[model samples]
Target: MTAAPAGRPRTARWLLRLHRPALIVWACLVVALAALLLALRGPLTDAAAEGWRQYNACQGRGRCTYDQDAILRYKDFAGYANLALNALPVLVAAWAGAALIGRELESGTARLAWTQSTSPARWLTLRLALPAAAVTVGTGLLCRLHRLAWAAGDGRIDTAKRWYDLLTFNAGGPTVAALALAGLAAGTLAALLLRRTLPALIAGAVATLGIAGAAALLMPRLWPAVTLTSALDEDYPNVDGLVVDQGLVSATGARLPIPDCDTGAGCSAAYDRAVGYFTTYHPVSHYWPLQLTTTALLLAVTGLLAAGSFLALRRLTGPLRTAGAAAGTPSTDTLAGAAA
Candidate 1:
């Protein structure tokens, strides 16, 4: 058995054991990323280049033109497509948090670890730190990718209805804000309530999924305070003219086809086209910041829940005998304690 080092708190002794699962998970994540890169890199890069070439060939004809700028935009947008692969890894990570405390409680393992050399708190804290670090770094990478998307695409990346449209879809977005908060809540709830690994794991999964569902549903509403203006889904009745918001030129700006209109009745066809195009005008410039603020609000809610979990974990030194018992958990142990 490994001995505790001199002068270190009992907490230090358990740190190694706590990090064991995290190390394994991180190693697996590395392998997965590597394999995915190897399998997808050639195909994805070629697709990006090909798409760029097509965009360049299609330019300025009013259908869908591609200039060098458009090519660069497509190239950058392609980098974040791997994020569609985000669900699997996220499922793994969300599970890891619950695994930290939940498993120990499951097999009566915590009774062994806690009494042998360390307090439950120390052991729990060490476990949380390892995976939390991994999430932090991993998400950071996602943020970088998002930044490149803006750069490579020359700021023309589609912000509407795109999966990566939200702030959390960027590299660090899921980890730092979503996964991290959910992980903490799941981990502690697993420990304080289930007191057993397998059940705790299930509970954690439910909690994570619940949060995701809730975020998708309610997060948009959180930014009513900061969302400058809502996108009006219903049409306006400027039948003779068009009303627009926030764009120098609309997304599909077409030249006015009607020759000098000496009067309103001159060319019905040209007027109809212009009116239709402008009526459909929906500027996306304000969309990004609105989305970002909403995500921040969701992150705040996550932080509050995680903090509650910390408080819950701190008071218990034993497995929770029932779901009801687990409900009482709460603590102020700090974020580091919920790391794994």
Candidate 2:
């Protein structure tokens, strides 16, 4: 085999050539989703909004007629788009773990690259950086488009998803991009730790999911919530957003959980001490704050994962490193054995 050129630019080109199929698939996915989101932001949303306006205008009148099909179509399209965007992290994780890192290590290709004047460190860095950049750009475009699509429907369509809806929330901000990066890092680390394809793929996906779940659980607390109280005689505060907590507030200014009482009399008795209801929530205005905070958190996790990948690479090639330093370079067979 011809000796591979030594330089970051040439290495990047080589990596791209090796991963062209995966890159093509990724690009296709992004472009397809981007097209869908563009429709949602423009034509689909307009039709749905028109349908809503017609329906609302015909309320309390005879022969109510509206473009119900348009409304339903928009709902279905938006739902699928949201779901696909949310699933991008898992797709990225699986590909990174199984194809990018794991397969190369398993097939001895990584060792071959290392023998061609590419240090294990540079090889790993290129793997992580190249995919990370692609993931960020692709995921970021999807996120922005999804956000715009959702925003175009907001308020205009009566059944449009709220800013707080988990699917919609995850699909519409920097959080998804951050999660994708984290997934790449997680996959890289898992592959390095396992040095096998299947196990690494599973571990990477699970790790990314665990990270996502943790971020979701902590999101409500990441920002300060607004507490709104309403007298019992009135309906609960009519605000719509991500609710942290809701319960009864006693006349003495004490918060209490709403007791489970079915019968009217039972409910009255259960709420006898309560004078009003209180709600703690993050309003629409807090959307950016929550997104930015969660992104910062996932980025931190990604950094740690990248660092761990490097450490695992060091441990895997310890003897190779010492030998290479002493004799200018270790043999390809030794690198392959270390990888195995």
TM-score of each: 0.56, 0.90
Q: What overall lDDT goes with each candidate model?
A: 0.48, 0.88
> Candidate 2 residues 81-192, lDDT tens each?
9889988998888888999999998988887777766678977877776677788899998999999999899999989999999889988999999999899989989998
- lDDT measured at residue 21 in model 2 versus the true structure, 0 to 100: 92
What is the Cα-based lDDT of residue 241 in candidate 2?
91
TM-score of 1: 0.56
Worst lDDT run of 10 residues, candidate 2, spans 318-327
What TM-score number comes out for model 2?
Answer: 0.90
Best by TM-score: 2
173-237 per-residue lDDT for model 1 (tens digits):
44333544455556566556556566666666677666656665554443332111222233332
User: Which stretches in model 2 have alpha-carbon errors above 4 Å?
Assistant: 1-8, 262-272, 322-327, 331-340
